[model samples]
Target: MSRVDLKVVLLGNAMVGKTSLMERYVHDSFNCNRPYQNTIGTVFAAKRVQVNDVTLIMGIWDTAGSEKYDAMTRTYYRGAKAAIVCYDITKSSTFQRAKHWVRELRSIEENCKVYLCATKKDLCDEGFVSDDPDIQNVVERYASGTQTKLFVTSSKTGENVVELFDEIIQDFISNPENLQKVEEAIVLSKKTGERYCCAI
Candidate 1:
């Protein structure tokens, strides 16, 4: 099978469920009883996905959302091929913070494909999120302005999680330039004897 390696990063504010989303996607399971704990640094997980005849090993990086790790989190943005900027549907504030992450990613990784994800869809369905009309307005406006794809996901139900990563992999395959960049980065890292974070 043809093989390719891709780097994807998850970014958002604390409690936006970035970690849970990663777990659900990578492990196909979610822990409802798991206690809340701050992700201190970054967690890396890889899954091999078969898209047609190509095998894509996605190295996903889940970064800490605490403000204390803002600098450290930004460091991981260096060579990401795609970034899933997530927010909680129930909290409009999380969506606001998500915008900031998107801006940072655009500035740092101009070529990176960004997906604006609203998390906790189940909460929204259960009327947990307040009637924040402004939130929808803002989300629509911001996503349009940035020309980013938007996805509503529920980690608890495993909704849209697989589709999200599969779309990313398909995008990588469809874009020759993206594939070339990853290959170039690998070659350069080999020469320097360093680990290559795939080129953004």
Candidate 2:
């Protein structure tokens, strides 16, 4: 089997549906009333996304969005092959939080592929969204990236979730040199202490 190891850290402010997005994508279901769970440390989920002949294993680390847990988050980003900085379309602050994560990832990941995701499209689609400029401004900031095709997603209605990972895998494969860096990072991290990062 052709396997692609893809580790993604989902980052954003609390209550922004980061976990809900993962549940929707990985399980194809969403619960609007699940009790709050503390992911201040980390939460992990794994699923296989098949793209052509490659079996891509996405080790998703659903991370805490609180600034208090920022250091913990950095330690977890050690060997991430990719990151999906998710934000809530209805909440502009979450979008800013996503931007912060992008900046942090840029420093830690030498060659990690990344995507910016806007979760909870249901809010906007259902007309319960806020009149927030963050949504429009964030989209504009990430337009080129999302266009070159490293951009936004809505896991609620299954938008771009599959395509996002597909593009990451294809992009990584297209750049063999970068893929080597990814593999080396993973191996070295494992040899040390990083078995895997949390993706709650």
Candidate 3:
């Protein structure tokens, strides 16, 4: 089987469940009671998936969301093929921060496929908080404008995590032109001496 590699980044504000979503999707496991530690710079994980006739190795970079690490985290965005911009459904500020992340990603990697993720759906379902229409509209507008998809996910319940990645892989596989763009970006970044944040 021929193997293709794609780089993906997770960007959002602190404590917005970026790591949780990543862990759930990559490992098919969730730890609700696990002690939370802010990601220092970036965490790397890889999973191989089959998309149509292609075997894709998704190289995922779980970036630190703290402003203190913004300089460091921004470096990982270069040449990324896709990005998942996550926000806590219960926190309005996180959603705002997610928008900023989306803008930053677009500025840095314009061709990168972006996915706006409203995370912690289980908490939203439990009455901790309800979705705000204004925020929903903002995300919807961004998704529509960017020509991408929006997902409401719950790491605790494993909702939409797998489906999100599945759609991403399928989208890439089906779009040969975009896949070529991703490959070209990787080659150009390498030629320009850009650091590779995640291994393929």
lDDT of each: 0.83, 0.69, 0.81
Collision pairs in model 3: none
Q: Residue-pair clashes per candidate, as listed? A: 0, 8, 0
Off-target runs (Cα >4 Å) in candidate 3 are 1-4, 130-134, 177-200
What TM-score does prediction 3 earn?
0.83
Top model by TM-score, which number?
Answer: 1
Task: State every prediction's TM-score relative to the real structure.
Answer: 0.86, 0.76, 0.83
Model 1 lDDT-worst window of ten: 191-200
- State which candidate has the highest lDDT: 1
Task: Kindly provide the TM-score of model 2 when superposed on the true structure, using C-alpha atoms.
Answer: 0.76
* Candidate 1 vs 2: which has more lDDT: 1
All candidates in order of TM-score, best leading: 1, 3, 2
Q: Residue 81 of candidate 2: its Cα lDDT?
A: 73
Residue-level lDDT tens digits of model 3 in 41-118? 999888876554444568889999999999999899888888999988877789788878888887878878899899
lDDT order of candidates, best first? Answer: 1, 3, 2
Q: RMSD to the native, candidate 1?
A: 4.8
